[model samples]
Target: MTKITFVQQDGVRIDTEAENGSTVMETAIMNGVPGIVAECGGACTCATCHVYVDNDWTEKVGGPSMMEEDMLDFAFDVKEASRLSCQIKVKDEFDGLVVHVPGRQG
Candidate 1:
C-alpha cells in the first residue's frame, strides 16, 4: 500500500494508506479525510476531488490527463500544483504523496 497525506483546509494533516489500483480520492474518503468531496466518484467528470500536489511530489505524481486538465477548470484555487485526486492512481511509486485540499470548493 502507498501512504498518502492529505492536508485539509484548516491545516490538519491526515495520513493514510491507499491500496494499489485505488485512486487518491478513494483513499481520502475511506480514511474520512475532509475536503475531498469526489461528487462524481472516480469518473473524472467533476473537480470536487481537487487537490494541490506538494511541489516536491508533483513530478512523481505526474500531471492531469487531458480530461482531468479540462475538469480542473471547474476547481477552486487552480494552481500549477492543482490536480484532480480521482485521476491519480495509487502506485508503489506514490508511497509518500502529499496533497493539500483547498479551503472551499469551486
Candidate 2:
C-alpha cells in the first residue's frame, strides 16, 4: 500500500493507505476525505475530484492528459498543479503523494 494525503480547504489533512493500482480519488473516497466528491467516479468526466498536487510531488505526479485537461476546465481554481485525482494512479513511487482539495467543485 502507498500512503497519500489530502489537504482540505480548511487546511485539514487526511492521510490514507491506497492500493497500488487504485487511483488517488478512490483512496480519498474510501477514506472519506471531504471535498472530493468524485461525481463521475473515475471516468475522468467530472472535475469534482480535482486537486492540486503538492509542489513537492507535482513533477512525479505529472500533468493531466489532453482529455483530463479538458475536464479540468470545469474545476474550480485551476492552477499549474491542478489535476483530476481520478487520473492519478497510486503506486509505490507515490507513497507520500499529497494533494490539496479545493473549497468547491466546479
Candidate 3:
C-alpha cells in the first residue's frame, strides 16, 4: 500500500493508505478525505477531484493526460502541480505522496 497524505484547503492533513493500482481519487474518497468530492467518480470527466501534487513529489506524480488536462481546465485555481486524482494511479513508488486539495471544485 502507498501511504498518501492529503492536505485540505483549511490546512488539515489526512493520511490514508492506498492500494497499489488504485487511483488516488478512489483512495481519497474511500478514506473520506474531506476535500476530494470526486463528482464524476473516476471518469476523468469532472474536475472535482483536483489536487496539487506536493512540490517535492510533483515530478514523480507527473502530469495529466490529454483527456485529464481538458477536464482540469474546469478546475479552480489551477497550478503547475494540478492534477486530476482519478487519473493518478497509486504505485509503490508513490508511497509518501503528498497532495493538496483545493478550496473548491470547479
Candidate 4:
C-alpha cells in the first residue's frame, strides 16, 4: 500500500494507506477525508473531488489530463497544481504523496 496525505483547508492532515490501483478520491472517501466530494464518483464528470497537488510532489503526480483539465474548469479555486483526486491513481511511487483540499467544491 502507498501512503497518501490529504490536507484539509483548515490545515487538518489526514493520512491514509492507499491500495495500489485505487484512485486518491477513493482513498479519501474511504478514510473520510473532508472536502473531497466526489459527486460523479471516479468518472471524471465532476470537479467535486478537486485537490491541489503539493508543490513538492507535483512533478511526480504530474498535471491533469486534457479531460481532467476540462472538468477542473468547474472546480473551486483551481490552481496550477489542481487535479481531480479521482484522476490520480495510487502507486508505490506515490507513497508520501500529499494533496490539499480546497475550501469548497464547485
**Which residue runs does candidate 3 get wrong by more than 4 Å?**
none
The C-alpha stretches of model 4 lying farther than 4 A from their native spots are none
Residue 13 shift from truth in candidate 2, angstroms: 0.9
Residue range 40-104, candidate 2, lDDT tens digits: 89899889999999999999989999999999989989999999999999999999898999999
Q: What is candidate 1's lDDT per residue for 1-106, written digit by digit as tens?
A: 8999999878889999999999999999999887888889879888999999999999988888888999999998899999999999999999988999998765
Residues 12-72, candidate 3: write the lDDT tens digits: 8999999999999999999999878999899988899999999999888888898989998
Q: Relative to the unseen true structure, what is the C-alpha lDDT of residue 17 in candidate 2, on a scale of 0 to 100?
A: 98
Order of the predicted models by TM-score, top scorer first: 4, 2, 3, 1
Residue 84 displacement (Å), model 2: 0.2
Candidate 2 contains a number of clashing pairs equal to 0
Clashing pairs in 4: none
Model 1 off-target regions past 4 Å?
A: none
lDDT of 4 by residue, 1-106 (tens): 8999999888889989999999999999999998888989889998999999999999999998999999998988899999999999999999999999999998
How well does each candidate superpose onto the true structure, as a TM-score?
A: 0.96, 0.98, 0.97, 0.98
Off by over 4 Å in 2: none
CA error at residue 87 for candidate 3, angstroms: 0.4
